[model samples]
Target: MKDIVEQNYSSSQYIVLIFCRLLIGWHLLYEGVVKLMNPNWSAKLYLMDSSGPFKSFFFWLAQDKIILPVVDLLNQWGLVFIGIGLMIGLFARLSAILGATILGLYYLSHPAIIGADYLLPNEGSYLLVNKNLIELASLLVIYLFPTSYKIGIDRLIFKKHE
Candidate 1:
């Protein structure tokens, strides 16, 4: 078996990374729970309000009677699972990547188009970028570092064999 490579990270680095992980996880969990509890909640409006060149694709998804429900289920569950995984530092790399992917799709759906305004949650305004993009970047960083290997569940479960 190939030995697992260990990198030395400062305590401050671990603190900051774990903090980011927990915060992002909490955000995802909150969103998922909100949507899950609200029986009337639906992403239809969000999709319909999508802009940019991919507006039609999103609109199509919104209007699709068959696919919309599936999307909803997957979206909700995806958030919950990713949230739990990240929060617990279990399979964090996978969770982070998935989270980043979802965030990317969100950014693409609304796309901080220049001179364009969206009816999204009050995150203020931007010309060609937004909170989603920022979160995606953070997720990317999380994925790259694989903090789970340092101070997460992955560290406990998967022991390195020399």
Candidate 2:
């Protein structure tokens, strides 16, 4: 009975992990492709403008000019790399971590785009918490589980090892 239960649980977990990988991969792919196709679709305008929520923070960063070039490069390349990695399940854990970090930074910077005031009682404006939180959770889940093995290059590599 115990063995049967363990097998069932493992099977369920496998299904869930596969779903997660597909969901995350597709989302990243769409976002990266959109950004790549539209070079003008940059976070700088939304993030560093006066109308932006974190206008002060972004303005300060621009003024001080600390790591601007590195940040810019990472912002561009990181999205593409993370998207590709997730799509192919290559270094999935690392990709998830990097993706989560980028998402967290975006969340922190904005936080008032969604307008969910009931759940979070803030004075200024409501934050886009739901999608960001969900994405963050998904990334963490992918990091914890071995989703790459289900339908990814990791499976081929590990098969040779075995």
Candidate 3:
């Protein structure tokens, strides 16, 4: 029997996935560009304000003068590259994984876990998980479903045997 997801999907499903990918990609791209445009911009504040379990590690990264710049550079470039990859449907799975990793870090930094209070301003209220977790979950969906075959470079590079 064919797998459930392997069954034919309506055009809407494909379009929705494409739109989701585009939306997330656009967000990542915009953020990266903004940071790149401003040399003084750094992830230091976010790192320093991190709460929950990884608080110490994140604080270390934020305060460590030597490592702070390196972290900042990687964070910016990772967002740019991952954004481009997702927008162009190039190495989408890899992009999704990378994006998830970035989001996971962000989520951990300002964890919305129940009963926890944070000094940082939040985009929205959440419990246990926030938009970051939601987006991360979306990336995981994209990774598993792989609509890249329908509208991505993966279609050409990873041709499936009939």
Best by TM-score: 1
TM-score of each: 0.93, 0.70, 0.88
Tens digits of lDDT, candidate 1, 39-129: 9988899998898999999999999999999889978989998998899999888999999999998999989988666788557868676
* Model 2 per-residue lDDT tens digits across residues 21-105: 7778778767767776775665554355423356577656545555554565577778778877787888776898998998776
Comparing 2 and 3 on lDDT, the stronger one: 3
Best by lDDT: 1
The worst-scoring run of ten residues by lDDT in candidate 1 lies at 1-10
Report model 2's TM-score to 2 decimal places: 0.70
* Candidate 1 TM-score versus the reference: 0.93
lDDT of 3 by residue, 1-114 (tens): 125225466899889988888888889988898999997899998887788888899999999999999999999999998898888888887998899999988888888977
Clashes of each: 0, 1, 0
Give the whole-model CA lDDT for all candidates, comma-separated: 0.86, 0.65, 0.84
Candidate 3's displacement at residue 63, Å, is: 1.6
